[model samples]
Target: MTAAEPNRGLIHFSPRSGWMNDPNGLLHYRGTYHFYFQHAPGSLVWDTMHWGHATSPDLVRWTEQPIALDPAIHPGDLWSGGGVVDLRNTSGLKSGDHDPIVVFSGTQGVRMFYSLDGGFTFTPYDGGRVIAQPSGRESRDPKVVWHEPTGQWAMVVWSDADGNGVDFFVSPDLLQWERTSRYAAGWFFECPDFTPMDLDGETVWVLRDARGSYVVGAFDGRTFTTAWTSPQTITTNPGAAGSDYYAAQSFDNVDRTVTMAWQGGNHGATWTGNASFPVEQELVGTPDGPRVLSRPVDEIRTLRHDTQSWPEATFSAGTHVLGEGCTAELEIAGASRACTLRIRGCFDVPVAPDETLRLLVDRGQLAVFSGLDYRCLNVDLDRRAAGDEIALVTDGPLRVSSLVLHQLRP
Candidate 1:
C-alpha cells in the first residue's frame, strides 16, 4: 500500500474499492457479525447509496462481502438504517433453513426489508410500503430495538418535528409499525440510536445522535423520558478535516454493547472512507447522572505482536521516539500534559492525569480514546507518513501512571 492506491488498514475496516460512509444495519446474524454501510461502488465519491456488506467472526478481523443492497434492484438510494435478526420468526419472513433478518431505511418515511438467505439478499416488505407516514415534518434513519418485557419491537427514527426530535414506533411483527410517541430536543438529528444498557445494576436507555451527543434516559417500550436537562457529548465534534468519527451504531442480536462509526477522513484515488475500530459501550455514573463511555473491543489484542510495557513514566518537554513502524497501539494512563501523536498526523490530544488514553494507529487510520472522549481519523499516504514525525511530545512536564506500546501485525 502506498500513496498511489489507498493504504489498506491493519485494523480499521476499509472498502475494497469505491466510496462508503455511515455504518448501517450492524447485526450479529447466525455465527458472524455483519457490517452494512452506505456505499457507492461506481466512484470514489458519495453518490446514490447502496448497502455494502462485510462479515467477521470476531470484531477484529473482517472480510468484505458482496454488495447487499443495490439501488437498481433495491429501490431508491437505500439510504441508512438499522437491522435485526428475528430469531423468533416474529416477522414470519423466514424460509428454508435460516432465520429472517429485518432491516429498515428511507426518507420522510420508513421502509422495511427482510433477508431470508442470511443477509445475502433482501426483499422489500409489502413491495416497499411506507409503514408509518411522516407527522410533523421529514423522517428518516430508523433504528429498531426489541423490548422483551413489552414483547414488541420499537424503532427510533429521526424526525424534523418540533425543531428536532425522534419518533418512536412500536411493532409486533416488524411488518407493521404504529407511531406511539416522539422525543423532541435540540440535539436529536440524523442517525439516531436508542439502546438499553445496564447502569449501576439498573437498566437504562441511552438516546444518541450522529455527532456522538447523547443523553441517559428511561424507556417503557414506546415512550422515552429523561432528566438530562441537556445532552452530553461522548466524542469530539467532527468539524476538522482530519478528525472524522460520526454516525455510530451498535450491533443487534448481540449480548454485549459494541459499536462502530464511519471515519470520514480517508480520501484516496481508489476508495474514500473506512469504519472506526469497534468499541464496547458502557454506562458509568457521573456527578450529573449516568453517562455513556466507550473503549476499544478487547478482541483487538489479537493483533498485538512485539510488545513492551512500563509501570510508570514521566517526561519533560522534548520529543520521544516510537521506532520505525507506523502501525501500533500506544496505551498511556494518567497523563499530565498535551501529547501530539504522530501517525498520519491524526492523533493530537490533551491529557490531564485524570483519565486513561489509548491510541490505535494503522495504515491510514487513527483512533484515540479515554473515559471522556472517543475519536477516529483516516489519512492517505500522500499527505503524511506515520513515522515521519515524533511519536510523543509535551510542552511542559508530564507524568503517567503506566505506559505500553505494541508492534501490531497486519
Candidate 2:
C-alpha cells in the first residue's frame, strides 16, 4: 500500500519523493548547512541508495536541494558516510578558495567524493573508490571528524563482525586512513558517530551507535574510554516505546553539537522517512549518572503561528483539552502522578518531572520530543485527526508548571 499524497512535515525534513533513511554527511559548510541522507529516489521502499541533499540557513527551515551523489558514480549502491570541508587543502581536492567539500561512503570500499561548488554537487575522486573494503565482514557508515589535538582527521566505523564496537581510523590527508584503535563495548552496530561536547563545563567525547544509544567518554584522537552509557530507550514514558529514532548523526564546524535522526515512520507512504528536528546536544549530570540531554533548537519557535498559554494548571485523571493539533511545548515541574498528553487520540506523550516536552502534530502523524533525555516518539495514525483540541489524562495528580501551545505554519 502507498500513500496517495506525500505527507508534509512542518519542522521535520522529508523528500518530495522516494525513500530516505540514516541522515548522512551532515556538514556546516560556508554559510549554509547541508543535510544528506540515504535515499532511494524511484520507489518508496528502500532500494539502491543515493545521497539526497537539503540545505538550511538555520536548523529550523530546510529547503530540498538536488541529489548530491548517485549510485552510478560508485561501484556499489551509495551507503552511509560523512562529509567534511577540506579546509587548508588537506585532501588537495579543493580547486579554489571555497575549501572543497569531501564526502566518504562505503560501496565496494571506502569511496571518496568531492564537491568544488560548495556542496551543491559532487564528483568521484580518484576513480571513485579510495580505501579497499575491510577483510572478512562488510562494514559501512564512516563518520569523519577533525581531531584537533592530533591535528589530523579521524573516522569511526562500526561492524559487528569480530566482537568489535567501533573501528577508529586516522587520516592525515583525508584520503589515506590507517587503523589506530578499536572499541568493543556493549552491543554496538552500524552508523558510528563520535563527537565532543561540554559536560558541566568540562569537555567529553560521546560515541553514538546506530540504535540511537550513546556512550559518553573521552577520546584522545585514537582511543575512547567510556564513562557512562545511555540507552536509546531511556524514555520514562510507555507511549514513547513506539519511537523509532535510528542512525542519528551530528555535524562538525558548528559551535555546539547538533544531532538529527531518521524518524523511521514507514507507515505505508508513497514517500517514506523524515528527519527529526535538529536538537542541541549537551551533557547533563544526573543523580544516577552522566547522561546526554537534548533540547529542540530555539529556531523552532519561529514556526509558531497561533498561541495559547496556561500557567500552573491542575487537572484530574481524565481527558483535558489543552489546544489544537499543532506544535505545543509544555513544562512540567512537579507532577505528583504519571500523565499522558494526547491529541485526537493520536499522540500519547508521558510527562516527566521538571522536563520540557515538544509535540508536533501534522495531519496523521505525531512527533514528541522530551527535553530531559532527548527521547522522541514519532507515530503515524491510520486516520487524520483534525481540530484544535488536545487531551491530557492522568491516573494520579497532574500539575503543570507551564503550558504553551502554538499552531505551526507550513
Among these predicted structures, which one has the highest TM-score?
1
Model 1 residue runs over 4 Å out of place are 1-8, 238-243, 313-317, 334-351, 379-382, 386-390, 394-400
lDDT (Cα) of model 2? 0.73
Task: Give the range where candidate 2 is weakest over 10 consecutive residues by summed lDDT.
Answer: 233-242
The 10-residue segment of model 1 with minimum total lDDT is 381-390
CA displacement after TM-score superposition, residue 56 of candidate 2 (Å): 1.1
- Cα error of candidate 2 at position 386, Å: 6.2
Model 2, 1-410: lDDT tens per residue?
22234345655778878888889999897779899999898987778898999999988778888888987755555899888887778987767658888888984357788889899878887777557344326677888999888899988877655665777888889888888778876567678888888887877888877766667788888788875543443233322111357787898788888888876664344577788778777778878667777677777778777787767878777787876654445444555566777776655678766666666665444555665545555555435454546777887667877777777765
Q: After superposition, how far is residue 146 of candidate 1 from its true place, in Å?
A: 0.3
Question: Per-residue lDDT for 262-293 in model 1, tens only?
Answer: 88777667778888889998999878777778
- What's the residue-level lDDT of 278 in candidate 2? 83
Local lDDT at 29 for model 2: 79
TM-score per candidate: 0.91, 0.88
